[model samples]
Target: MMPDLPEQKGFLEQEANQFFEESFSGFLIADEKNRIIRSNKRVSAWLGISPEEIKSKKISDILSIGSKIYFETHLSPLLKMQGYFEEILVELNGAAGKRLKILINAKESASKEDGLKLIYYTLVEASDRVQFEQNLQHGKSRAEKELEAERENVILREQLIAVLGHDLRNPLGAISMTVGLLERSIKDERQKKLLQILKRSSYRMNELIGNVMDFARTRLGEGIVISPREIDLKPVLEHVVEELKFLFPDRKITVDIALPEPIHCDADRIAQLASNLLANALTHGNPQSPVSFTASNETNKLELSVANDGEPIPESLQAILFTPFKREGNRPSKNGLGLGLYIADQIAKAHGANLSFTSNEEETRFIFAMEC
Candidate 1:
């Protein structure tokens, strides 16, 4: 199967020439001065120029303006120092203002005899890969911009709620004063009942306004501000119970307090917490059953609880019970802003206490416990 030495050498030379002409990538040979000594047919096809015209031109002649600067300033120096470079991204100028993206590899020929230097280059088209990278970068920028805009909108909306809640308080105060003045002169039985209704509605509105302002403040990151001191919490709880009983005369609310010592807490805030809990029970508990409220201090631990007979809280709702603006969706009365329990929980947290609850077919109970 062996051929003669002269015939084997000829066959190898023919095979190498065939491969050089048939390669998919563009090819070029340049001297040390950077002038193209030879270029393949593929290079002529890519640039829309004839092979005869491409020869003797500098390699930078076909590069885009930006790529030309990069080659002279960075790529060329790096190639000479390292003797080779591969997979460098660059763009070539093509016909009709088109840009042909390509990955280029270049190397200096190993032979350096008689001061002769040659460089070989291979250029591969990379249009699809480059376009995909550009698209990914564009999407990332758009998402970041959208997220920043949403954050600004949320801050603006919370500020608006705070301003509106503050302005409404003055007018609300005037209405309450007018109702008080009219109550003193009213004597008719039916008229007195109507006045009582107005009084209850005004009281409810006041409670709602307070909750709105608190909600906005907390959402805006101000949080619940409290001043704690040693105080008798029993009277505070009792006062809240009496106020709620007056608000709903037909409903019965039972209370038991056995605090023998003062506890360190913000009295006004504790009263507000108790009031919110009592109001929620009156609104949602079974009409025929009485709400049970109890406060006690045992071994320096303060524990307060409110319980009432009612339908058990839904499993799904219990998870978000302390989240603002959420309420029992199936309940008949949806009059509130649903911030009562949320505000109460926040107040407890501000005082380093825990507010927890339990619900079942028999009763639903909320307990607030803290160390005195």
Candidate 2:
């Protein structure tokens, strides 16, 4: 390519210089020591200084105290190491103590013979961007604090429930004892019937209390406690099925057990889990069909299942069936507090076992599997 004529070159140079001075952003030319050698018209106007006045002034002179320190300690060293720097945020001090947040870009170019090699800088106003970042940081901090507070509130609520559940046990026991004694002394048939009703209601209340306490214990991070022992689970399974039958005499229950050897387990908790599953089956089973209980203690593992024939549980409800306080849509909410399955599942987990279920138009079954 051939060089342009001098007049034509002068015209292009003038046009380029005009665009550089009148551009929207600020621009500066500084010597190797960071002394301002020249500045564009826009920068001079924004800082309330003429181009002539800005010349020979150190960049530190136009920066806020903090920015001045950062520029010298970090920005300068980084620019020296990399020969280029971009988007380095700095607060520029202007006339009348005004401050402007700006993003700076600095680059080292070829040395000039005219006077000294210079650093070229470009600055963009970043007040809004800085404010946006600050707002984001503030919102993040607020969310974290709120989440922590919510967790504490849940812990406190669980503690209170546990305390209340514990306190009710003594009075409940007294009431149960009194009711039994009253039944023994009563002679009238009607009075005996009333005592029976009282006993039933008391038993139900006691079960509810137990559920609440267990829920509290789990939520408060103290899981269900168990005392494991070597024992045959056949009798335990039979007794639990018998108890459920006694509670709901109208409901038919069938039990099949194959435990011929001792199994290490917490019998009380196992019985509770069995009762819970049976009760659920009774609540939702086909009235004419018998609820089935099956247990097998093979050499490797123990498996127990409770099944009843009825309408299939809704698919959505099945997903959360073992979560606390959630009842199936078709089930009566007034019948119980909706904790039976949840407590049973938790007990299974504590025992290093699993409680699972399957439901269809024909039947719904809750099955427990455990290591022998």
Candidate 3:
């Protein structure tokens, strides 16, 4: 000022310079005619130019074609009317043709009083952020394509398995009937014993074929047709337990049904769910230990659980237990293709239910629940 103002003004200027240099975003000062008056080091670095060299240059000279068009059409009009614009994405071209995506924010400076506007701009490079987003989108697209292909493959494979199982059943049925007739016709004890062996083998083959077909039907979404009728679950659970007892005669299994009377659900699908879960428990659980089945009604949902005292599911295998063909630990001496839980899960989901599990060293329980 007219008075001595050198020291105080110098201190303020020094602070401003320090602030500008420390900022990561590029900063520029331009006069009303869009001529650069001053620029920070960040801006000079971004444009691959000396700050002094850019002092008299026009702002449009460094913008890419698209960015220039956008500035002319949208930013200039908005700035003229509003005195500022914020966070507009634009591309800047460097001296050697390097391109950078930048988020630009501009505002008119209040200190300009010569009937000329002084504009201040901040530029933030968004190249890395944009690249990351594109990569994420690409990964998502790839995963979707792979999932579609896998679904198609599963459908084709299941169709073939169903056809093979059907064909095998006819021949196996004839062989069993022929063996029964031979058993009655034979006189020698040894011959009778041999025919008995043939009968047992045929029966075992039939069981394997049946399992394959059942698994295939479930995998290909053709297993059960649900007719949403008012059906009770107590009787279905009892029937499933009885059938499982017959299926695994050697294994000791216990069934406990504790519902508040009649509970409505998709009867056939619910039965299939129960049957699959019990079958899984019987197949994987220790024969000496008892498998437990329980059902109850809670609030607006019906809950069912199948539990077994088996070797604990390993931590590594627990994450993907419901995925098709995912098997863990030592395979049970019983031959299985590892689709029981997978089928149970799908059936539960189709019926608007969720399948979940809990496991420890002593017991493993798989639970399914649906709206009552």
Candidate 4:
């Protein structure tokens, strides 16, 4: 055997080979004149060339258009002037028209025995990352446009409600005043009959005006005040039931007060809530069946359910039942504007209460509950 080499020399060779073979980064070694001397498999694969083909090729010939200019103008000059250079990014074309991003570095070898100065390079693919960034920017732009459009729509709706409410109130006030004066002045039987017709027309107009005002207030975020107090709800439920009984004498309404004691709530709002629920039940419940109103305290909440045996609300319509001005199938002319349930829902929420519903062939219930 030949004389054993020094341990340090053997170790260095092993380290150099390990660095080239195990690295995920593409590496290449070139001579002082920029002629390729050796390259790792990664580098050969990146250029679509075999190790044999890469051995004697010039560095400028192996590089893509962008990388060539950068290496000659910046990397080569720096290595020659400073003896070593660190991480310089460059692009190169790969096999099958692919492009790659690479970091280039160069340094003078520690041993001068071989007349070889090594220029090292590491490559990484950046096309996917670049495309991801571009897509993110595009998505942000689209979301901003949608937000601007939604804001414009809200502003337009508020403006329209304001104009409509103002115009409607003026004519409605005049007609109401005229009807009141005619009721007092008309004395003859025929004139009284005509005055009755005028009064009825004025009443319908007033109802429409009230609906318009309520809708405007809802849109403008007005008319919701919740001041909770300890009050007896039994009297309130009974009063609402009595009022409904008088209003709809043809239909039967029953009030079942399970909680005889007091409960905590905003009394005025709860009264309005009860009235709205009872009215809804009366309007939609079958004439042959009686509308039921039930209230009780359960767990930490005071629960109230107004159920009616009527035509089952379809599954699709249930989602939008609480929406403003949304009505079910056509009914008689006596049905008023669909503001009652929407207002009741708003009032319930303001009091930290939840309003929900369940409907089936046998019964339809609107349930409202508030924590005690």
Candidate 5:
């Protein structure tokens, strides 16, 4: 802390007056009746008047009409009781009819025995300060408008994505049905094989559309929807496995399910989450190893896990494993909109459950646990 000042002799009236005349502020002294008793050269120059002329005029003569009224109604009563006021905004009616903004700090300097009182005032130019604040407020308003516009554009883009994803569904369904019918009637083995390829490609496209729709729904603040009921999880798991097994006949998917009791959850949504996890395993797991699914119900919860032997995921990737559209750029061969895990996680959350994972050199596994 800085040391306090030492006591010293005060300047005499002549020295004080001379210092006041040379000060930067517009300095003035006025009596209790508001007549100008004295003013410094700074104030005299500001008013475009001589010092003698300023002394001859009332202080109100230099004030704008509004400030003169404010001074009488507010500042005078406040100073009378409190003996001082600081940084009060007032305007002066300039000699050329231009109004100049001023910041005033005033104090009661003397209260004589004869009931005469004197006040000291320092006036500062406030036009630049007020203009700067206005400019700052305008800039803030412009920034807010730009932000709002950007938000609206994002909403429009999400709406377009949702519409496109929805419209593609009917055509995709027709294509799948047409291909299935052709596969059943085809006599040539080679034509049958080509039909299978078409069928698989169409299914992949359909899955991509579904993921995009789910992602758009989430962005629009509509989370996954589920209808709860007591249902066996075994059938849901089997259905997903059987379909995936049909698509990838060369790969093996084995299921081992033993439920302690019926689960209270959304059966279709459970199937979807399981399907997504299986797809991830099939796409990323080593082709030589089979993907394994095991599900069981404990006394307090129903648990399902999918495991595959593959190169372990990097530790950095685990942090964003369930985030939407967070795919590794290096894996260009992978086909997805990167929404499967995110949608599965949302589904699990909607059912008041959690999706978690573990990975090492041996295998990567995803677990879904739902409390009863």
Candidate 6:
């Protein structure tokens, strides 16, 4: 049940009086005729008058002429109609006729039995109010500029993607097609070899473009987007091995995959990741010793690894191996931008997996593992 309103009013009034007495801001109680009946110590200090001497002073006597006119003309009528007026900017006549800018809040209250009215006033320095408003405006402006810049950045990235996907790829596609047509007509062995070189260069160029697009999307755009579904992962692995074997004909790549059931994954992305890892192994591994490709899907887990016999990756480089455009400084094969491993790692991450590696004097192995 609600407490009696008269009792609540009495309790609230006592609390309000305590609050006004301890407040840093000036407080005053005035009669209906605007004669000050009581003033807090803060008001006495600002006015350079004793509390007892401040009593019986008219509110207009302490206000600047302009503020006195404003109080009588606007604020007084507003308070009478609404019973309160808050945050009205005004000026007070301080000691020695100095002007003090302030904000005042005044409320009119009446005694329940006698109907005698009293006005309570709260005074605060306007300097703090002005500073707070300035800070708020500055923050709002900064946020708006940042939001606009982000929108512009998004537009630029989309344009980059369109150019990479359509404009650049279309020309590269034409070159590949023309190379295929010329190979059939060429008869001289030297000419044929040159054409073959051109073909391989085009293929490499296309691969580099694909890597760049994937990097931009995963790092700059949203992230590696995947269409995950149940897929026969064994065939996907086998295809990647076959493709890499064709590209690096002399380098042997041994595979051991045992996925007895369909695995849930983004098959094409997984294939791309496998191809990247395997290609990196072929490029750096000891030619005489075969690169090892292994995978297994068992008991709600999927794991794949590519191992190559090589000198150990440097400890410093290992820490930043998955970082884009970073590579082993000591390594010799510097064919393309160092994005292959970075893209591979991104693909692994897209599938809720992590790509990790360990290196020793004997071999370097990269592994991708996740819950299926």
Q: Write down the TM-score for model 6.
A: 0.66
Q: For residues 295-352, what per-residue lDDT tens digits would candidate 3 score against the true structure?
A: 8887878889999997888788889988877776565544556666776787787777
Candidate 4 residue-wise lDDT, 1-372, digit = tens:
676679978998999899787677777777778788887888778788788888988777777897898788987898789788776666666777776766666776654666545665455555666677789999999999999999889867876866786788788788768867877887899987776667656654654555456566767677566688889888888887886785576888777787766788888778888888887888788889999889888676788899999788877768888888778865442376777788788888888889999999899999998888
Clashing pairs in 1: none
Off by over 4 Å in 5: 1-19, 56-59, 69-85, 94-98
- Which candidate would rank higher by TM-score, 1 or 4? 1
What is the number of backbone collisions in each predicted candidate, taken in the order shown?
Answer: 0, 0, 0, 0, 0, 0
- Candidate 6 runs further than 4 Å off: 1-29, 32-34, 37-122, 185-187, 219-222, 228-232, 259-264, 283-289, 298-300, 311-320, 325-337, 370-372
**TM-score of model 1 (CA atoms):** 0.83
Better of 2 and 5 by TM-score: 2
lDDT winner among the candidates?
1
* lDDT of each residue in 1-372, candidate 5, tens digit only: 865444322346557778899987888888877788888887777777788988857667789999999988898899889999999989887656778889999899766988778888899979899899899999999999999999999999999999999999999999999998998789999998889899988988888888888888888999787899998778778888898997888999888999857889999889889989999999888888999999988777888899999888877778998888887566434678789999999999999899999999989999999898
For model 1, the local distance difference test gives 0.91
Better of 3 and 6 by lDDT: 6
What's the C-alpha lDDT at position 108 in model 2? 85
lDDT comparing candidate 6 with the true structure = 0.86
User: Against the unseen true structure, what C-alpha lDDT does each candidate score?
Assistant: 0.91, 0.88, 0.81, 0.77, 0.86, 0.86
Off by over 4 Å in 3: 1-9, 21-24, 50-53, 81-83, 109-115, 180-188, 226-372
RMSD (Å) per prediction: 3.9, 2.6, 7.0, 8.7, 3.7, 8.3
Among residues 3 or more apart in sequence or in different chains, the pairs in candidate 6 whose N, CA or C atoms overlap within 3 Å are: none
Could you tell me the lDDT of residue 370 within candidate 4? 85
Q: What is the lDDT of residue 357 in candidate 3?
A: 94
TM-scores for all candidates: the values are: 0.83, 0.90, 0.60, 0.54, 0.87, 0.66
lDDT of 5 at 238: 86
Q: After superposition, how far is residue 108 of candidate 3 from its true place, in Å?
A: 3.3
Model 6 lDDT, residue 369, Cα: 96
Tens-place lDDT per residue, model 1, 137-213, is 99999999999999889889988888998998899899889889989999998998988888888889889988988
TM-score ranking from best candidate downward: 2, 5, 1, 6, 3, 4
